[model samples]
Target: MTHLHRAFLFLGTFSSLVLSAAVSHGQSCANSDQVPLTKVKLEEIASAVGIGTNDVELRFEDFALETVRPGLPIPHNNRFFFSADRRAKAGIANVVPDGVIPLITITAIPLKTFIHSNSVFYESKAVRRTRLPPSYQKYQILGFLDALEHSPAGSEGSFVPAIVFMTTSDVKAISKKTRLLATVQGVGILHTIACEIPDVLPTENNLQMGAAIVVNPEVYILNISFPFPSPPGSPGRVRP
Candidate 1:
């Protein structure tokens, strides 16, 4: 029962706990084939959890248990863009326009939801912040192509408006400095599209920015193909 021996015992126990927790997290997130979140689920979670509302507080102390269930359907009408391998590449082809793409292997407690832990404890007014969790604070990872300088056909704009949950890690991992002629599958043909760095929009916070793209007025996207790297035989297109 020496003091040094006791200290060593405590450290060993702590390390064991940490390692176990990490392994459990990895197992949950490894289910990459989990069902994508759908518009219905998005609305359900938003309503159940009060996402996009003034009440920007954690509904529970532990997000891992109370957070929206992992593997919920990702919302529809979201598309991801990537840097083109060829400068002359004009469009992405042969994609399931009405299909869903699972970009992130979502876990019960997203890394951001845990890392941005202040939101769980502080009031929005107290922190002088606006956007709330389950939506703004906790977002799915998305691929953003930094190269495309697309704007409204006649007007040159730097950013476009998009709707989805994106993480900072996703942004850093996918954004390539090269640009390309981006496009989405239209009703009868592939319509040219442009990807832009989103600027701040007038949300409740008025300081939130996102990754977005431009589309032709005639073309409405029913679904999008997010080009995140996936394991072989996984659903959704992995190539542009």
Candidate 2:
């Protein structure tokens, strides 16, 4: 299908998804007429892609971008709350008078740099509700790599090679430490890190990270540097 047609289809599917989610909230439901962004006159788009003037600001949030409480005819304003970043590209547009085509701005933010080896790896003390699975097998870690890198490789260009963590059943379980994972800053589309452990957390090395993967900057990272400080009488040295 055409891009515009697909965009509209996405809108419909998205709305239906929202309605389904809201129903789970135990909130009363009602059908409200909504307008698509096509009504606002996207200069790049030569013709109307949708009907109606009702539109909501799209913000990347907790489960991907969508209105706060969609399917309801309520006024919600989406003010530009993004700042400059070298890794992310921000886009802006607005509704204007029928005779005027408003100016739009797009900016890219750097969300990947924060995930690099140099960033902070906060501990549980930082306060978080995310509890990953107790143990993640090698296959799981590689699954993540496959999704991120499209395949595990050390090619000429790609996000930094993903370190696959070995299986471990508990946080205290010393499997191995490899890299320094960091939580960054901002409302981002970050995946909850699950499963695996490093053989050794890098204390020194030219360890780099992916250049532009969009992710939340406020997640958590465990500060891992050295032969991990294990419990009393336990093997402190990283297992080869």
Candidate 3:
């Protein structure tokens, strides 16, 4: 099948999963619409995803260059709020507790950075309400190398790797400290995080937030020195 066909199939499957989840949860089957997700619930969900409450925050806006750049034009919609290192210190945290906050801890690469890194992973499968079998022994992790070898051009890029936690019986038996593994075909295995939170949470255009990869920036040395001016009328322009 063509890459376009695969994408369609992939999206269709995920759509079905979301719809099924909404119906199963009695969220909004009457209008064929899903229920809205809440911030408190998102925190619970993120926590269940194996990250601490302080480690993950829900983001509702597109990332801007200002995050990595300064003195740039910042387009604040006033609709989305973000809380983080400098943002929180700037009183951005007074807006809402669940507004976009840091999803990882200090010293860990930011979620945006991870999304743009080469160490990211992803899962293409739709999660169900059923429990993952204790005897289940297969992997479903998709990584960068696998994308290079398998994903179609223009589509092989970084994405937030999401793993769904089942809210059924099997999860209850697993300890919160225990980490499960799910492998992707031809790829590596991802640590499966089990949360009791349901999938009925609100989503933007039906797109639920996925799991995130953690990365660290490279260590580099900075040599700071002012350049000496050349003789008068030098070919190079000098800073005033």
Candidate 4:
């Protein structure tokens, strides 16, 4: 057989192998379902926050997820804030009260599995230095919360603290630009609740709100009647 023919045969075999591997991976991912949160888990998470099982619900307005990329470092997650009515009713609403929000978050990453499977080129400095995408970081917080919230009631578990976790690079980047209270709308009754770090150090690594509500002490049962903040120069109440 000619050298060129032998080379072609080897190349064809390599291509076929690559294609097969790709197809297998695609199938595996397609079959994998994103785990769902269960009711039991939610109760556990609530209990951790010093609330009874009945006091907690998975339903929170503006539950969202955000992504983080390298160099641009900010930590965010799928967060749930009480509505004004619920906040009042729950008696956990606070406006800049000293303490942390009694909330928890969890996170998971599929890329870690990918890195584990493909050992080759995994140990490179670049790969080692690379951080989990911002979305994954946020998701980790959600996952942890979800797991705790979904765990079966009566299961032996402790409440997880609210702390933002990220790679050192990301943390440094966030420290420079991040604010203690991130004023956001869509919290319904809890709209005024600020997203701030807890006074305690070495807290859970992620965005967390204090469990206690103090802003409008007179108001109990945060109803969904509050208005959202207005745009710049618009005739509306500015979010503090």
Candidate 5:
């Protein structure tokens, strides 16, 4: 067989294996209803993957899968801030105190994944010189990758944090930006919540009220209601 043909076979096998590992069926995801953003609700689903299902869910890798799950509506999963580091510990701040920022649909991968896959190009001095966070900072997707900026309460134009969803494309289109677009098909959320960070690092356990970057913007989305979302000023606990 040709070298190119052999490479394609390897890629296909690798993709299948990785996807299977990412997707785990949970007990309650059977319904299409927007999963509530509440801690109890999310933990129940996170439990399906054996993440230890604490009162607070801190598994950012597994958390990313939830954001992309077929059964979850874009708005549903966009509820809380997730971090691969978990040290920032922004896991339980559901729906931001400012309340649902926005939702944007774009095809995208984790920034860490995108970087590592292209590490061949950036592996040398380039990786060292680049300002990008390390691969362990998986919650990031590069600053302003979403091409979106949201208005705040009255007059501020703070780029509100958003919940973003990745959709499949049957055909690919090429873009010519060639400099900083995350991907032609990729989309990412920009807020302290997802990376393109909001500088919530100094906050009390990285809770919603502490997210000063987009602090208390007028409600943007999640117009549909859910039961017992975290209220402002009360971040609850980061972990149980």
Candidate 6:
């Protein structure tokens, strides 16, 4: 089958899977209010990734979860709110708490430095893209957030916050090769860039961001760096 044909088939199958699960296991917003956001566990995230509870773990700086209320569409204003790192850890705490269980959306930063340091592991591209079952698309906003609290000081790079809209088209584009594509200032004047993931090499020392790799619709690879130098008189150009 051609790529487009395969993509359509994949979408149909994926939709069925998502719909089936939603009908059987889906919880309502009222249910969300019963379980505190702070009480979310690894199992919840695992479910989000379409993995069994045994397949996932709660690690520092791993996946981020955002709670979206029912009847509300994600990206309501071209932006979404995520729990602070502290709140996230609290929800995953062992102690159960009585409170609203906010509908959870997951996110992560695929930082080159972190990947190079071996602090984070990348999931397979196929698994990342198809695992979630796209029915969650409306309720979930999958993308990366620019580091606002921890960004470098006085860096030339703009630090606007932004999110990526993942689609089949995006996944196919990144799956071919690795290279930086484009950079621009997004929300909050933050700098963002997209790159294609390179084929893995045995001798390679570091895994970089910016290079795209398909890792679920909601997961994003982030490139945090200073803007490139512009020509002598172009706009936003700076002289050394």
TM-score of each: 0.20, 0.16, 0.19, 0.18, 0.21, 0.19
- lDDT string, candidate 4, 113-145, tens digits: 111110000000001222322122223322222
- lDDT (Cα, tens digit) per residue for candidate 5, span 88-161: 33232212211133322221232221111100000001011223332212323222222122212111221122
lDDT of 2 by residue, 1-240 (tens): 999999788666655544333223221111112111111222112123232222211110111111111232112223221212211222222111101111111213332221232111111100123122212222222122222222122121222322211111122221221111212111111111111113323221111111111121122111111111111111111111
Tell me the lDDT of model 3 at 26. Answer: 27
User: After aligning candidate 3 to the native by TM-score, how far in Å is the CA of 107 from where it should be?
Assistant: 3.1
What tens digits encode model 1's per-residue C-alpha lDDT throughout 89-150?
A: 43332111112222222223233211111011100111113222211212111112112222
Q: Is candidate 4 or candidate 6 better by TM-score?
A: 6
Best by lDDT: 5
Clashes of 3: 12
Name model 5 segments beyond 4 Å from true. Answer: 25-144, 147-240
Q: Model 1 lDDT vs. the true structure?
A: 0.22
Q: What local lDDT does model 5 show for residue 198?
A: 27
Q: Which 10 residues in a row give candidate 6 its minimum summed lDDT? A: 231-240
> Looking at model 5, which ten-residue stretch has the lowest summed lDDT?
117-126
Q: 3 or 4, which is superior by lDDT?
A: 3
TM-score of 6: 0.19
Candidate 4 has an lDDT of 0.22
lDDT (0 to 1) per candidate:
0.22, 0.20, 0.24, 0.22, 0.24, 0.23
Q: How does residue 55 of candidate 3 score in lDDT?
A: 44
Candidate 5, residue 220: how far the Cα is off, in Å: 29
Residue 223, candidate 5: Cα error in Å is 35
| Candidate whose TM-score is highest | 5
Of 3 and 4, which scores higher on TM-score?
Answer: 3
Task: Tell me the TM-score of model 3.
Answer: 0.19
